[model samples]
Target: MAEGISSDYAVIELWKAVKSIKKDAQDVSVIEGNIPKVAEMVMEYILKNINYFVPINNNLVRPKTYPIDNDPMSVNWLFVLHTLNFSLWYPKGTKQWKVDGKKGYFGLCNAIRRAIEDGKPIWNPEYYTKMTKSELECILQSDDGEPEIPLIDERLRILHEVGEVLLQKYKGTFMECLKLSEYDADKLMKLLSMNSSHIGTK
Candidate 1:
């Protein structure tokens, strides 16, 4: 789907890469003796939590603190959320960034929700395409006395980059891309991989 790389080729390459790494790695080794035990444990866990594995069941349940729902806006919100999801981990001994008393990924979600509640059209490509560093700082600000979110400038740049892509090519909404993909997960993935720089193929 990405130019010369077909889906099948990508899968084959991924498998070969993993195998090569496992063969050459000095620091990590597979425990063949533990395979059966680990398999049993995994199977037991899957059996015990099979209900949670139902796609519809989990899709119906989401934290209220997330600014998402069963709509196109939710798709765009998820796009924005994942675009800024990285580098949340702070250095050892540093104060964790927080929002609405939550830390890490939850903190990011709460910040986006708070921004929407405060009338910031954060999910809209038009707004984020031109968003300033100062505005993003305010949106992702942490609790009092805590360090700021890590990689704040990188996040801002990524938002602007992806926002411009959406605005220029996808009609300012990811829904257009989804429609073009006809709701096919593989097609959508390929579409994103081909069009967006930050949305990695893996």
Candidate 2:
């Protein structure tokens, strides 16, 4: 992500980092078949569904139940969701956390949807500023029961930070920020990355 490095070069560096970290971190044989299959499927999927850049479609991105037709509100909802989109790893041996039969990040999506459905003020920055642990717990409840999303405290802090920033600088809507970026992907990525450092810390 350094300045002057083309995306191709950044990808190469990322692959190198992955190779180095995974080399000693696990038994290579354990992931030998899995990694290749995963990579092949990812490549195939991307090639099959490649798309031209378009303005984000909030309806498509979020669960159907929490539809917010108002463009600014929809954008605010997406911003809230993205604020929690980091470090979803669970304990090594536990059942993978799931919601509505979806695992990993998809599961997280449903969990957020359910939280909103259950009336969590998911799109409101002022609500997040006063959110409590119990309230967050309610938001992260698993569909299968007895499991919870990891990093509740950290996620809560991030939520608050993102919400507060949206309120203060963008009139509580990330759509304003998006407009400031003129709908440019690079500008938006930089904006998000800069905000990431301040996540959960205001």
Candidate 3:
């Protein structure tokens, strides 16, 4: 859509950022040289204060928010959630995911890619964080209107295999990546949250 309007990114950015300031502003005839500089300025304005935008039309959508950018929680949440849902996905979380130690980050990062595509939240993986032991048991028992615990390792294994994608490949859109069952993911996150913290890595 932007390319159809003009040869320059600056002009496209100007149109996206502004309404009818005057025909002169749109004219671009007065501004000569440094078109890239202008575009860079516009991008800086946007990237620095992305929170200020409220898009005008269906043609415009905000870029995906990232963990490295303004909102750190989004990235951290998805990463953690991935770990909780499957131990095999990342090396950091639990032994459950080790899966012969052969399948690891590749799996986690891929899982992250899927979740980013889906726009679902990557929840905080530290299962015990903010949750009490009573909370944990209630979760385990399917209390508080949640699902029952997975006592079965096979189910956990499936989760482990799927969550292994998030560690590296899918960087820009962790929040949008696909999600596991909120109930199951939450339980695992809580469990890892409690147990995984003090340990050193292999």
Candidate 4:
């Protein structure tokens, strides 16, 4: 970023370059191959140079979620990893943790909202990549140590708690609705037989 330039401008310029190249590239794999180079540029301009104002958690404005390191590959490789992870959620067989919680940030946002709205019970833990609180703290804790990878278990636990809080508010009503909607074919058949006096006597 320039001394006086804004993050929005920096991101726009970066995306223009990234998209132009991506438009002609064969596949995301090719983009993946070049990620390190893009990552280097992002580091140089955004992470290392860091002068502009960057915001987090703003709902009113469009989020420009470039990595804090400004590593374009942070954004790039992230997309590839997230897409692959989410695809694993709908399983063909056993839903091992590998794909069970593989939702992107938006997906997690929706899941949390649904859990809250539907009065669903505790959120089932899945991997929350960006919201890895422990990992973030570990990164802060280190001065020279390698950045700590997040504990997937702890992350899931947090989601479960959050889900529980949301669901508790409406759990009774939601469960009642669930029970009422459940089918009882035999009981329905018995009632129908008893009420069929005028039905097809011929």
Candidate 5:
């Protein structure tokens, strides 16, 4: 996979960004630096508190019966899907505000799972890269009388970008980026953030 874009380049660029900030702006400095001991201490603290790092929970948006089920690619695809999951609120005074009693993020998750059941290629990046608005609308369809989710075009764009990046840089699996992180929580966060946007600096 050497022919693919080097993730090392991203790490190096992040370091450069970290160094360019003013001394007074020490947010990234607290997270990264040449101080090995401080870095080790941070990692140890994360390890000690790993149980609290869980993002998924009973109250979160997820498939009821475990849709992915040992499929790493599907799990990664879920992460990619969530990267752009937002703005699901309906207009004020709308009578229909839910998709089969699931509203907002949960409603979105329900619709996506239903699409997968209906044979949409939810786990295939190639399919999403060229997904059409009509197709997306179909997949995102709400229950009858319910308001549709907002930002259809932005969702499609995010899906396209995620598909392109995964195929080009991570060999069609977000786990590749995870592997590159080598079990370090900070590096994993940085790698994932590189795909989205930078924080603290901008």
Candidate 6:
């Protein structure tokens, strides 16, 4: 079994924390009257789209533009993707960084795909641990005249930090971490939160 608190208790603790904060929260308040309406709306929508909610559905799969596959490397690829997923929102009126005409998150996805196509082993901790700013620039380069990806330096630092952790603690592959979590999603989340500074538990 995974160590530390159980996932059920973790959720209960989170609920308690949120409730405590909500009591004193001035800027935000949950309207209890809207709960049933919201729940009904959600249920109606889900029921209306029940066909898409099946176990075998591929509608929720990642886009084809992403550099992922049915392999352990995809886990590390996702790790890298989410590590740099933040700070994508840019101020209005500014030129957005794009890859293959896709902006923001999809742009980042395409950039990773493009990098992999160019023979860059971006999913490998060994490769990313030594990745330099210039290399990342090339990987995430935008269309001509477009602005560079935001927070490149911070993203690079996070990548280096996570890559080192993967190498030193998780055998350079996220698969090992997954194994340690026994394929439990909650355990995996806690493991990532405990191990990586960039990924914290809410």
CA RMSD per model (angstroms):
10.0, 10.1, 19.1, 23.6, 11.9, 10.3
Clashing pairs in 2: none
Q: For model 6, how does the per-residue alpha-carbon lDDT over 6-28 read when each residue is reduced to its tens digit?
A: 23455467789998888999899
What C-alpha lDDT does candidate 4 achieve relative to the native structure? 0.36
Candidate 5, 1-202: lDDT as tens digits: 1212223454466667657764557454464455798779999997887776444453353456345557655666576457646766644345433555766665666776777778887767788878998888788877874456677887887888777888888888777777899868899888888866622222
lDDT of 2 by residue, 50-146 (tens): 6631223434544554555764467777667767766554544456556787665666678877877787777788888789888888777777675
Tens-place lDDT digits, model 1, residues 38-85: 999999998898877765444654555655356658889988988898
Question: For each candidate, what is the lDDT?
Answer: 0.80, 0.70, 0.40, 0.36, 0.67, 0.79
User: In candidate 1, where is summed lDDT lowest over 10 consecutive residues?
Assistant: 1-10
Tens-digit lDDT track of model 3 for 54-162: 4422124422222334555655645554444432221222222221121333333433434445553434332223344444333223212322333324434433333
RMSD of 5: 11.9
Per-residue accuracy of model 4 over 48-125 as CA lDDT, tens digit each: 545452443333332233233454224222322232222212222322221113233333333333433454322221
Q: Which residue segments of model 3 deviate by more than 4 Å?
A: 1-66, 78-82, 85-103, 124-202
Rank list by TM-score: 6, 1, 2, 5, 4, 3
- Which scores better on TM-score, 1 or 3? 1
Q: How many clashes does the backbone of model 2 have?
A: 0
Residue pairs of candidate 5 with colliding backbone atoms: none
Candidate 2 has a TM-score of 0.63
The TM-score leader among the candidates is: 6
Off by over 4 Å in 5: 1-69, 95-97, 197-202
| Residue pairs of candidate 4 with colliding backbone atoms | none
Strongest candidate by lDDT: 1
Q: Output the lDDT of residue 147, model 4.
A: 24
TM-score of each candidate? 0.69, 0.63, 0.22, 0.22, 0.62, 0.71
